[model samples]
Target: MSISADSIKAFYKDGFIMIEMNKGVEIRFPVSQNRRLAVGTPEQLNNIEISPFGLHWPELDEDLSFKGLAAGDFGQHSGCPTRNRRPRAVAGR
Candidate 1:
């Protein structure tokens, strides 16, 4: 599924990044869940630029994709605990 965010806002008090999609769906996630935005200050988070593909915070140098957010991804890369993947089984177990 493809999603494009029409607007985004930083809710500093709640520590959430709120995104409004083109289809009128809103998605939100804790700032701490995202690696780059995890340590950003209120001022840094407030300074955001919204694009058709994603959101960019030039001050904090953080970018989040709309589709990824819609899919429950908050910028955690491979090996990150938030991925929620189970360990593979051994062949000879």
Candidate 2:
């Protein structure tokens, strides 16, 4: 994992730092062990989310779920950009 000094600094402070990658360039960090995830528009790509090992695009209002990503289908989903923050929990059917 290639990390810059600034990234290191953010990690030390808030435990995370977003990295805005340039368009057309291959992402250095592994999104999910070789599976490259790219947002279609600059509005999507402009915001970067850097967690301990996850990213959250706030502009998109989408929580990029990453655990057990490749093994299941959720990882392959490109969530639609949303602006609502309503609870999505559902009761037992």
Candidate 3:
């Protein structure tokens, strides 16, 4: 099944990005996980465009798919490197 985002928000102060899914699911991850997001300022990070399938940050020129995010694949160019491993998804509250 394909999951999509209803809305996305970047919490710069908390250093996390949160996505509210169409089915009332919320996924949150650290900003440090994505290279572009890690370095983005509050203004830039907050500029999110949500599509049916994913989220986009035009100011940072970054995109993250809902499927990928659900699978814990932040990005290929993540700020923090993992050793051939995928982090577990954080369930919504």
Best by lDDT: 3
Q: Rate residue 32 of model 1 by lDDT.
A: 83
- Which is better, 2 or 3, measured by lDDT? 3
Ranking by lDDT: 3, 1, 2
- 54-81 in candidate 3: lDDT tens per residue? 8889989999887888888888456346
Residue by residue across 21-89, what tens digits does model 1's lDDT show?
Answer: 444667788888877788788888878787767778897787877677778877865348547768899
The TM-score between candidate 3 and the true structure equals 0.69
Tens digit per residue, CA lDDT, model 2, 1-93: 333323421111122223333332222322332122343244444455655444555655544433432233323333433423587889994
TM-score, candidate number 2: 0.32
lDDT for 61 in candidate 1 is 80
What are the lDDT figures for the candidates, one per model? 0.71, 0.36, 0.74
- Which candidate leads in TM-score? 3
User: At residue 92, what lDDT does model 1 achieve?
Assistant: 95
Q: Any runs in candidate 1 off by more than 4 Å, and if so which?
A: 1-13, 77-93
Question: Model 2 off-target regions past 4 Å?
Answer: 1-40, 72-93
- Would you estimate the TM-scores of all the predictions? 0.67, 0.32, 0.69
